[model samples]
Target: MAEEKSNKKTNIGEVVSDKMDKTVVVAVERKTQHSLYKRVIKRTSKFKAHDENNECNEGDIVKIVETRPISKQKSWKVEEIIRKAK
Candidate 1:
């Protein structure tokens, strides 16, 4: 039998902060319709992602993938930089 490998979860978001060494905070926003109000709403979530080289900067669009916990608040790592910050 062959072993199965599950795919990790990924998210595309903007880097909100990168003041920490080798770490960046990403803000992922999503649009969804309210269950009761039936109105579209924008939801934002903050995630702590590991940046091995600390190349991310504020306002940069990046992709993050789930991984083994590296710290108390970091369970995700920056996969790639989608867009550079202006």
Candidate 2:
């Protein structure tokens, strides 16, 4: 059997249900170590992404990635809409 390969990437985020039609909210978190202080810090960002199928709901964690512009500043699209909100 041939092994299928995918060059896709995934990002985790929080699902926010709003009146924006087929869109969900995603949060990206990053941790960096301070070079001078030698300490670690965390940074997070929330993004509004498009989910046409509504497969993901509020509080659901999902994976997304950079893609062609679906809309203004919407180059980041959902790669996989997670079924469970973990």
Candidate 3:
């Protein structure tokens, strides 16, 4: 098998809003265990990713990849538009 490519991995999130031009807001949520308490906690963060074209819309699940800074607070790019909003 060919060597698998490994780059900066990113979590998939739903597109909460895509009103901004060339920019989209993705909501990524993850569960982590507390170091001492050992209790799982749900943490969510909104990421501003660069979308070259206006291809994604609200409620769409998409994938984004980490990349060099394209603008202020923008270090990620949309990789693909996975699913459309239901």
Best candidate (score: TM-score): 1
State the lDDT of candidate 1 residue by residue for 34-83, as single tens digits. 99999999999999999999899999999999999999999999999999
**Candidates sorted by TM-score, descending order?**
1, 3, 2
Output the better candidate (2/3) by TM-score. 3
Q: For candidate 2, write residues 8-79 as lDDT tens digits.
A: 555777666535767777878889998899899998887778777767777777888766678875666667
What is residue 65's positional error in candidate 2, in angstroms? 2.1
Estimate TM-scores for all models: 0.91, 0.73, 0.87
Model 3 C-alpha lDDT per residue in residues 1-86, reported as the tens digit of each score: 89988678776999998999999999999999999999999999999999998899999999999999998898988999889998
**lDDT against the true structure, each candidate:** 0.97, 0.73, 0.92
Q: Against the correct fold, how does model 1 do in TM-score?
A: 0.91
Residue 79 miss distance in model 2 (angstroms):
2.1
lDDT: which candidate is best?
1
